[model samples]
Target: MKRLIRRMTHLRHSDDQISARVRAVLVESLYASPRSLIIGALTSSAIAAVVAAASGDEWLIGCAVLIGLVGAVRIVDALRMRGSATVRQQERGYRIGALTYAGLLGVFGLLTLTRTDSGVLDLLSVTTAIGYAAGIAGRNAGRPLIALSQLCFASLPLVFGLLLPLDPLKALLAAVILLFVLAMSDITQQTYAVILRATTASEEMAALAEHHAGMARRDDLTGMANRTAFREHFEERLRNLTASGEHLALLWLDLDRFKEVNDFFGHLAGNALLVAVARRLEQVLGDRGIVARLGGDEFAILCGVADARAAGCIGSAMLEAVRQPVGFNGHDLRTTASIGIAIAPDNGRDADTLLKNADLALYRAKEKGRGRFFFYEPLMDEKIERRRQIALAMDGALERNEFELVYQPIFDLAKGRITSCETLLRWNSPQFGSISPAEFIPIAEDNTLIVMIGDWVLRQACRTAAHWPADVTIAVNLSPVQLRAPDLTHAVLAALSASGLPPERLTLEVTESVLLDDVDRSLAALSALNRIHVCTTLDDFGTGYSSLSYLTQFPFQTLKIDRSFVIDLEHNPASVAIVQTIVDLAAKLGMRTVAEGVETPAQLDQLRRTRCDAVQGFLLARPMSAPEVIGLFAEQAAFRSNPGQPALPGAD
Candidate 1:
């Protein structure tokens, strides 16, 4: 009994799961339209008229009247269904009414069969009953149960009445009618299955389309609105705010030093950190605004505010939220964000304009020092336009011969002669003459123009130094962008092979920033250079964190103390101690040291006492053109030959 109850419950649950629309459609198929009902009623009246006229049977006439009444009632019910709450509500009533109509037709047919002896009456009544039963299958197949019930109600009585004659022909006819009823039941079941399958597949397709649309608007990793969706929302909000004259703030957020995290940890850890940060931003903003991940480590926020002060407060909260360290893979990944706020109406109201200005402000924040926010100002646009013009001019600056290399000699403090010259890039554009390296080199790096420019510098420096005295090596600065290039090692080899300069005569100078990005890759590149007998010098030594760790990681031939330490060596005891300590450490590590920016004789003398290997500064020589460098080498050779005169003009 329990098993039976469970099976019945399961069936009921399955039935209840069908959508309401499908159920209504099935019920609607059971009730004919008003026109169809009226036509069916008139047909019944006609059949009754024919039978009663032929047989002169008053009982047949009465049965026909009853059938007509039921038909009229069914027609009235069908008409009412047009404005009904739902077709499903009238399902049971319609089924009963249909069965009644079928039973009355069966009664009329039976009375005709009993009262008439003519073969015509018998044939007409029997044919009408079977025809009505067959017609029910086509009209009511959406509801198989009701269809089958009507079929049996109309046909079974005639089958029983025909069997009462006890004749073989009549029994065969009855058997044929029973067979017709069974075939109709199967037809109804098949038709119902087809309708149900079609309806269900359509519903599933609609739901799947809606799901895909939602996915298109969402970020895959962070599950926030993507760039495209954010833009649309931004435009829509702007439109809504236009008439109200209220201000909306668009905050452009960028994670600072995120690329370093990706380089140190793997990309998976970076992605996990991004997801955590997105959650924090969402939680911090809550219902006050909408946050979107606008690709990479950048995000955007939209909120209504009265002015820049309110926007600044929101930006402050966002910065604090992002400052929280996220734990991943047993390490606390700490990051900070820079925010740029552009207010609507005051900042030109359109999405593209506001976003561009906000991005400009964000760049300014990072430029000044990150972990802060800035509002868009009109002056920023002019500065950005200037930067854009500079970038555009740089695209073909090398091909136009606008770049030149100058050499600054590094003198041996004890030997009192130049040992190496660091090549410095200079841009003398005809459009904007004498652009500083500090301003333009960063612009080049930002646009990836540094890679091509750095390569040229390497080859040119090698070629220039090939003609110099063999004892004097050449140094070329490598940017962090160049180190990440896959062809860095190849570029170095090609430069050496083309210039006919020995690998030992070339020294590649790298700042500590290089090691901070992808330590393994940087070490591999440096190791490849070392294998080829090329020297690597760690420039700006004391400015970076983990300076000692970097020295142990790679085989650097020299450490150049930063100019900040060398400039104050005479007056500041701490600077003197730093220089001495670096000199001692470099000597112990078997690496040479050079003091940069040594101007005063006192600073140079102090460096000499500390046993610094070399010094490069304006005191000895400024960066000079290639021709001047060649002349200086010639002067040194002249001094070597005489053995009496000074090797340099200002030598001690």
Candidate 2:
């Protein structure tokens, strides 16, 4: 009998285990369906009502009410959930879900207090179970699986109640199954929400990283590759070309006199000019090359060309690109560029070496007169090395005071007397010996040493003029580079003040080329000097595009005829006629004219006949030391005293 009891106990334990497993599966399946949850609740309530009505118990009515209320609350929740899902805004959906869940739970709690008959309560319980099962199943399967599961579960209690005696065990078992199903549903929902959040966070992180990397690679101002990215890309291309036996070229481009643009028009206009230049380069190069701004007025291009000729073609295209004028700040601004090209495998195999060679070529291109390009060559490299040595030696030369000034007399045609002396620059390099102005002036201009050289010239000229007669003016040729320096006007004003010389006694000679580069700025500088009573002269006139329009546009106190015309005065009638016309024009404009390079008496005679206001040439005196000039004046005084009068011809 004991052995039989043990077997029976073991069988009952196995059945309990199987029932728990079935409950778990049902809970999980129903949790995934929305409609199943509402159906399960309704079935549970109906079963509770039927049980309460058949039993005819007063306490059973309370259970009936509780079951009905749970069903009604879940039904309302399912409807609200559907409504929330239809909303477009995510926040609004979440807010409605939270409010609906809370309200449903409150209604379920309130319904637990009312009483009803046992049969009715039992029917209500069945209805509630069905509604809950249907809601959950619909939510999981997107169908009505919950209603089927609840109907199946509701029949368990009804079948047990009708087949056996009434017991608390059946009621306890029903409550336990309901709680188990609810727990399973909550777990499924929480797990799905976690997965969704993880996916969203990952996508957001990827987008943010991509955005930052893009920003890092692009130039902030010009929207091109920045220097760092350019370097990397250049290196990669170099490697590819080396492997493929293909050739590439690097071009270094620099805008001539860009600083003057910044100084005159402000940074806003300067930025506009840079952006305009970038667009032009892109349009010109197209797919032939990649262009990058190497910071402030300097740009570079990398071209994948097969030969030097192809590279030359690219350079020519770039040159033509910048030839068009750019309008900025309501003014048409004209700019020119000097380009230098270095071929890979010919110039250098590496980035640094290639860039260095390209820069050397750029120096040569600028020296050859800007708005042109030069290819890298062995001879060009040699010349660059020589200049580098000279530049190094110049620093020491300045310290040792190797620089000297020479004065050339400016003779008045009307008075026939020396009225002014123009200061000429002379550099004596101890290592190189007497470097010519034509050679080193350009080097200075390129390296920006002209600012320092110009300052020295201005100070020396002012000091010399202060010692001379107050009426005699001193003319100093201001280089285009020096004029573009940020503090140029201030430097001139300070030099005049420091030397105790009057502004009226100082004459600044500017070339036609200076005026063409940023005419607005050039005019502004000239106007400022004029306001200070400084005499402004257009030097080297009739040489470059003699636009008389500039005369009306710019204020000038004097016009110096270039030496080219003066040198041909005796041979070329056209030269004579041109000089005559210039003098006539000056007279009409009420401007003074100076004839330069008057080496012969014939040229001087011609200039005098033309009513030239001044003449500066070897005929009067070569540029000499200040003391030598004073000595010459004394010699001339002595010669005048002895003149049995083979006297110098007075203004004819």
Candidate 3:
């Protein structure tokens, strides 16, 4: 757990240095105290000018005039610094002005002592007068170095001038001025520390705020900007386009088979694939535009383009980049992306419209065929709206009992009798009547409705098939979604117990590819089912990831030859060879084989010749209603038969 937290921390932005940022803020704010500094300087110059005139010393009057000149120059520089934007330039100007102010204070202290008849009275007065200007430096304590420097330079000169005179009062006044300078120096340092600490705290807060804002804008899983950031950034890009009317394209991409990845692999594996895809997008596009993960498996890109053809070229490149294979858990997994492009001004003038059009184009690309790209068209929105409505309606279809199960019988070709029946799901919606399983099934799987629907089908099939002959086994397909369910074994057992059916007469068929999702978990679930004597088979056998390894690792009872191979039996020798190979493999492994989509007696004869154990297709029987299932069995007196055993009376 600590390691996972550590990895997550590594992905976040590194924190900024509070002290350095605080320093920059202070330097930029060098003009913060100019008004007070000017007021103190003007007041000091006036008082020193009065003393200079009373003493009748020309040098004292000259010192006050010089101080006034320096004060005026510093105030001017401070104003210029306030107008400047650069921190470094502002800081340089502030330091020069402060030094000049310090120099003027030093000159005033020296001028008071430069008199020839400077007695104990004059010296004591000079020390007391220098103390007033020293207070001005204390007022500028936020600039500690300048404040402390001015105090020390101004007070030390007058104190030393007093020390030169051998008088108790002069020495006492000199010590008092020295004490004043020391106190002011401490106050300046302490005041600066308080200001600096405050600045540090403010900068820390700013940094923390920025970090949180960045987190909100970025996807945690993929390290790409999320939808909010994408919208904001794309709008900014639109605003920045030059008057030459440069074309910009917004490409929306969605992984074609991302759901299959999550189903076949686990979510962790799916997350890893998304991260890899994010990197690939970064590498392919590189600074040409912005690539962001809008949400799960969907991404959006904004890039500069000259025309529609340029956008198409970039979209094609993105498609190929996503098409590359990813390796996870010792398997090379392949996926493709369907991309949609929306050009600025051509598709839509602004961000929201362009994004909607891009998304529409993406759905059209997926609808046409996966692993392709499409440009936005106005009509695509209408088609996608219809699909969106269907998907929404499916959410309540099962609850409303719009779904039903039909059983297609599997016949023993050699013995000429029904061995088992495979359950097929069908949905008849009031809004869209008789939606094909191919259409609605994927939609359900994509939206996670399949798991509930699959569970319902399992229970229904078991309950309906319980009254069938004891020798007959009923097969129902298991979706990968159900296989991932934690309560799958319990659900199956409950269904069997409720239906009063023996586990021996119940079969759960899974696709070979779906079994790859957390293989241990699937195996453990299947193993638990096996303990109750339920039969397991790998259905649509040769269609995906056909590995002999799974056949051995899993206790699959049958390998159903896919319809594709069966249909090509008379025309394609390779299909025939493949079927023969699977049949021979199944036999040697102590498993049965069932050929699917057998529509002709010739195909059945060919399957029988190949020694395939059973056949299922329209030729034997179409999927029938539950009552029709009973009627056919009663009319035909269908009995389970084993080819290896001697044929009993009325077996065919």
Top candidate (lDDT): 1
Q: TM-scores, in order shown?
A: 0.64, 0.63, 0.71
Q: Across residues 1-652, which tens digit of lDDT does each residue of candidate 3 receive?
A: 2432342243222212335577677665556767866776676666666667767788877877887787788767766666645655665667666666666666666666667464543544464456554664556555555555566656677777767766788789789887776666666566766777887788889999999999999999988889999989999988887768689999999987687677667898898889988999888888998999998889998899888998898888888888788898897667889898999978877898998898788877877756899999888888788777789999889889999999998878666667688899999999989988988876776567888898899889999888887778899988776776767888899898889988999999988878764577788878888888999989888887746888878888889899999999988899899999999999999999998998876787788789999888887788999998888677455333334533322223
Error of 3 at 172 (Å): 4.0
Off by over 4 Å in 3: 1-18, 28-30, 44-65, 82-89, 112-132, 135-137, 160-171, 241-243, 259-268, 327-334, 407-422, 430-434, 469-624, 632-652
For model 1, what is the error of residue 370's alpha carbon versus the real structure, in angstroms, after optimal superposition? Answer: 4.3
* Model 1 quality (TM-score): 0.64
Candidate number that wins on TM-score, 1 or 3: 3
How big is the positional error of residue 371 in model 3, measured in Å on the Cα after superposition? 3.2
lDDT of each: 0.84, 0.71, 0.78
Candidate 1 local lDDT, 1-652, one digit each (tens): 2433353355346557888767776676655456766777778767877887778788987887788788888888887774555565588788878899988878777777667788888887778777777877778777666677788788888887788879899899889888887777767667767877886787678768888988888999999999988988999998888656568999999998676577667799899999999999899888877899999999999988877888898999989999998999898888899998899989977999999999889877877767899999999988776777788889999999999999999988767788999999999988888899988898887667898999999999999999988899999999987876767888999999999999999999999977875687789889988999999999999898889999899889999999999889878999999999999999999999988897877888888899999999988889999899989888777877887886554556
Model 3 pairs in collision: none
Model 1 weakest lDDT span, ten residues long: 1-10
